[model samples]
Target chain A: MAPQPKHLSGDKAAINEFLDQFDVFLLDCDGVLWSGDNLFPGTVETLELLRSKGKQVVFVTNNSTKSRADYQKKLTSMGIPSSVDEIFASAYSSAIYISRILKVPPPRNKVYVLGESGIETELKSEGIEFIGGTDPSYRRDITPEDYKGIADGSLLDDNVGIVLAGLDFHVNYLKLSHAYHYLARGAKFLATNTDSTLPSNHTFFPGAGSISIPLINMTGQQPTALGKPSQAMMDSIEGKFQFDRKRTCMVGDRLDTDIRFGIEGKLGGTLAVLTGVSKKEEWDAEGAPVIPAFYVEKLSDLMG
Target chain B: MAPQPKHLSGDKAAINEFLDQFDVFLLDCDGVLWSGDNLFPGTVETLELLRSKGKQVVFVTNNSTKSRADYQKKLTSMGIPSSVDEIFASAYSSAIYISRILKVPPPRNKVYVLGESGIETELKSEGIEFIGGTDPSYRRDITPEDYKGIADGSLLDDNVGIVLAGLDFHVNYLKLSHAYHYLARGAKFLATNTDSTLPSNHTFFPGAGSISIPLINMTGQQPTALGKPSQAMMDSIEGKFQFDRKRTCMVGDRLDTDIRFGIEGKLGGTLAVLTGVSKKEEWDAEGAPVIPAFYVEKLSDLMG
Candidate 1:
C-alpha cells in the first residue's frame, strides 16, 4: 500500500514548511480554484500569499477548448491574477509542441484541425498552418458526391501532414471521415489532451479524449496526448519555466490526472485539495493508482 | 504452429465434399458476392447452384447503414436474386434484440439513436419508439444555452432509456453530446455493429463501430454489440432461421469478423474467400487469431 498523505490543515507548521519547500508551484484550475463559474473562497488570497513568499505560480489546465489568452480572461473575470505566459492550456502546449518539436516538413506541413477555435488560434499564433476546423464546407452533411470525391482523393487536402484533435463542439461525421482518410494515408495523429469528460455548468460533458476515440478505433492508433499525466506536457512546462524539478510542487484536486501528472513528471511533491472530485477515502482505498504527498480540506487551508 | 487451411479451389472432389456437408450457407456480401458495385462473374451461378442442391442461403452482413429492404433492392439491381427474409442485417439484429430480448419497460422505453436512417427504419419496423436519429432539430451545432439545458435536464427527453449507435454519415458533436447525457442519466447502450472501418466505393471509411467509440470512452462502458461475431447476433439468426448450427457453413473474405463469427458461434465450418480483406498468408502466420476451415481464391470457385 502507498504511504498516507500528511494532513496539512491540522498543522500550521507543516503548511509553512510545505510552502517554503517549493520556489515554483504548478496548479490545476477547475476543481481546485473553483467549481464551474463560482470561485473558491481565499483563492485570490492564497495566490497572493504564494507570490508574496516569492513563489512562481503557473496555472496548468488540460482543457484544450481555451487558449492561454482565453484562460487569462477567465482567470481575470474570476479575480485571479494571471498572465497569458503563466497559463499553460493544453491547446498552447499542442501548438508549441507541433511548432518547436514535431516540426512536420514544409510544402506538406499543414495540420488538419478536428477541434475548436482554441486549437486553430494557438496553431495560428505558432505560425503552424491548419485546415478543416470550423470550416463551413467541412461542417455540412456529407453527400454521395462527397463520398465519391473522398474515394478518388479530390475532396481531401494533400498538405495536411498532422491531424491535431481537441474537444470540438461542431464535431461531425464529415470531419471524422476527412480525418480518417488523412490518417489512413499516413498523417501523424496528435491530441491536446485525453481527459474523458469535461466539467461544465456544475455537471460533466464529453471531453477532448472522447473526440479521439472514434479516430483511434478507425485508424488503430492512439494519438500522442499532450495533457496532464503525459510527460510531454511536463517537458514543455519544464523547458519554458526553467524551474528546479526538486523544488517545484504540483497541486490539484484530482488524483488520476493532476496528482498523477505531478508524480509521473517527477516533481518534488503533489498536494491534493478535497474540495473537488477525489476524497481521502480514495487514496486510503486498497491499491490506489496514485497518492498525494499532502492533503487539505480545501485550497484556502494553505492560508494558515 | 497452426495447421494450414485446406485449399478448396485446387480440387473438384474437395469442393463437392465441402458443399455436401452443409445444409445452409452464410455469406458476407461486399467481399464474397461482389466488390463495391461490381458483382463477381459467378456470384449468381454459385447461389443458383447452392439452391439447386437444397441449401438455405442467408446473407449476413455487419454493415448497419443499410436495412434488409435496402440490401434486397441493391441485390435485385445486381441480379443477385436475394429476398428480404434471406438477409440478416446488423441493423435488423439490433432492432429485434432491443424490442424482443432486452425489452426496456414503461414510459422510459424510447430509444435515442446516434446512427443513420437504416437503424431508424429497422427499429420502426419492430414498433420501437425512437428519437434523435436524422432529426433536423438535433443535427445542428450545440450552443452555450444548449449546454446549460443539457446539464439542467430540460433539453433531454425523460422517456429516452436506451442509446443505440451505428454508422452515421451525419454524426455530429450535438448527437454525441445528447447521447452522452442520456447514457450518463442511466440509459442502456446498444450498437448495431462495431466494425472499425466501412468498406465503400472500392475503398474504406469509418465504420459503425467508430461511432460507438466516443460514447464508450465517455461512459467507460462497452455497449452490447448486436452484430457479426457476437453471440447475440448469432442467437437472433438462429431464432429466426431455425437451422442446425452444425450444418451451417459461413463464407466471407475477412477472418476476424466472418470466420471468427462462424467459429465462435459453433457453426459446422467456415470458408475463406480471398477477394476482400484476408488472405491465406494471414491465417498461415504463427499465432494467428483465426483460421477458416477451407480457403477459396474467390467465392465463385465453389461453383465448380
Candidate 2:
C-alpha cells in the first residue's frame, strides 16, 4: 500500500512544520488564488505570509487563454503581486518547448497555430513565426466547397512544419483544415493543455483539450501536451527555474491535474485545498490516482 | 481460426454465383461509386447491373452534409438512377431516430442542433423543430465574453431537450456553448455519426465525429451515434425497408465503418473494394477488427 494523504489542521505548530518542509511553493491559479477573478478569503494574506517566510512562489496555470504577460497584468489588477518571470502558463511552456526543445529553426518553423492571441504572443515573443491563429482570413465561416478547395491545396501555406493548438474562441473550419493538412503532412503536433472544461464565474466552457480533441481524432495522433499532469511542462519549468525538487511543494485545488502534476514531477509534496473543485469524499475515495501529500480546508488555514 | 475475405475476379460464372447470394445491396458513397463529384469508371453500369439482376440497392452514407433530396439530385445529375427513398444517410437516420425511437413529443421535442442545413432539412422533414443549427445567429465569430454570456444563460434556448450534432461547416463556439447548456441541463445528446475524417478528392476533411468530439468531451456523456457500424442505423433501416438480412450484401471502401457495419448488422456478407481508404496490408493484418467477406480491386470488376 502507498502512503495516505496527510491531513493538516489549523494548529500553528502543524502549519509551521508543514511550511518548514518546503522552500518553494508552486500554485495553480484558477482555484487556489481566485475563482474567475474573485479572490477567496485570506488568499492575499497566505501568499504574503509565504513571502515573509522567504519562500519562493510561482504561479503554474493551464490557462492557455492568457499569455504570461496577460496573467501578470491580471494578477496586478487583482491586487496580487506577480511578475511575468514567475508565471508559467501552458502557452508559454509550449512555446518554449517548441523553440528550445524541438529546435525548430527559423524561416522553416512557420507553425499553423489553432489558438488565441495568447499563443501567438508567446510564439512571437520567442521569435517563432506562425500563421492561421486569430487571422481574419482563417476565421471566416467555411462551406463544403471551401473545404474542398482547402483539401486541394488552394489555400495551404507552404513550409508549415508545426501545428500547435490551444484554447481558441475563434476556432473555425479553415483553421481545422490547416491543422489537419500540416498534421497529415507529418508536421509536429503540440497542444497547450487538454483541460476539458474552463471554469468561469460558476460554470464551465470548453477548454483547450476540447479544442484539440477534434484534431487528435482527425489525425489519429496524440499531441505533445505541454501542461499540468504532463511531464513535459515539468521539464520546461525545470529548465527555466532550476528549482530544488526536494524543497518544492505544489499547492492546488484539483486532484487530477495539480496533484498529478506534483506527483509526476517528483516534487517534495502536494497540498490540496478545499476552496475549489475537489471534495472530501473524492479525496477519501479508494484507488484515487492523485491523492495529495496533505489536505487543508483552505490555504489560509496555514495562517493560524 | 476465422474465415478469410475471398478475392473476387472477373469470372463470369463465379460473378453470377456471387451475385445470386444477395437480393439487396447497400453501398457507401464517397469511395464506392464516386470520389467527390467525379464518379468511378463503370459505377453507373455497376448499379444498373445490380438493378437488372432484380436487387434492391440502397445508398448508405455517413455524409451528413447533404440531405436525401440533395443526394437524389446529385445521383440523378450523375446519370445514376436514385430516389430519396433509396438513401439512408446519417442525417436522415438520426432525424428519424430522434423523432420516432426517442419519442420526444412536440413542444418539448425542440432540438438544439449543431450541424449544417442538411440536418435541419431532415429534422424538418421528420416534423421535428430545432434551433441553433444554421440559425445565422449562432454562426457569428465569438469571443471569450460571448462565451461567458452564453454560459450565463443570456443566449440559452428554452426547452431544448435534445442536442443533435453532425457535420457543420459553420461550427463555432456559440453553437458548442448552446449544446453544452442543453446537455448539462439533462437534454439527450445525439450525433449523426462519429466518422473521424471525411475523404474527398483524395484528401480528408474533418467529419461530424470531429465536430461532436468537443461536446462529448465537455459533457463527459457519449452521444447515441446513429450511423454506420452502429446497430441503431440498422434498426432505422429495418424500420423503413424490411429487407432480408440473409440476402443483403454491404459494399464499402473502408473497413471500420463499412465492413464493420455489415458484420455488426449481421448482413449476408460484405464486399471491400480497394478504391478507398483501407489497404490490403491493413486487411491482412492480424487481429483486424473488421474483415470483410470478399475483396475486389474495383466494383467495376464485377460489372465486367
TM-score of each: 0.98, 0.96
- The candidate that achieves the highest TM-score relative to the unseen native structure: 1
**Which residue ranges in model 2 land beyond 4 Å of their true spot?**
A143-149, A152-154, B143-149, B152-154
lDDT of 2 by residue, B73-166 (tens): 8888877889889999999999889877998865677898888888889999988888988877787866677766677777676668899989
Interface RMSD in Å per candidate, to 1 decimal? 1.2, 1.6
Superposed on all Cα atoms, the candidates' RMSDs to the truth, in angstroms, are 1.4, 1.8
Error of 1 at B241 (Å): 0.8
TM-score of 2: 0.96
Q: Evaluated against the true chain A, what TM-score does chain A of model 1 have?
A: 0.98
Instruction: Please state the Cα-based DockQ of model 1 relative to the true two-chain complex.
Output: 0.78
The lDDT per prediction is: 0.90, 0.87
DockQ of each model against the real complex?
Answer: 0.78, 0.68
Q: What 10-residue stretch in candidate 1 chain B is worst by lDDT?
A: B1-10
Error of 2 at B87 (Å): 1.2
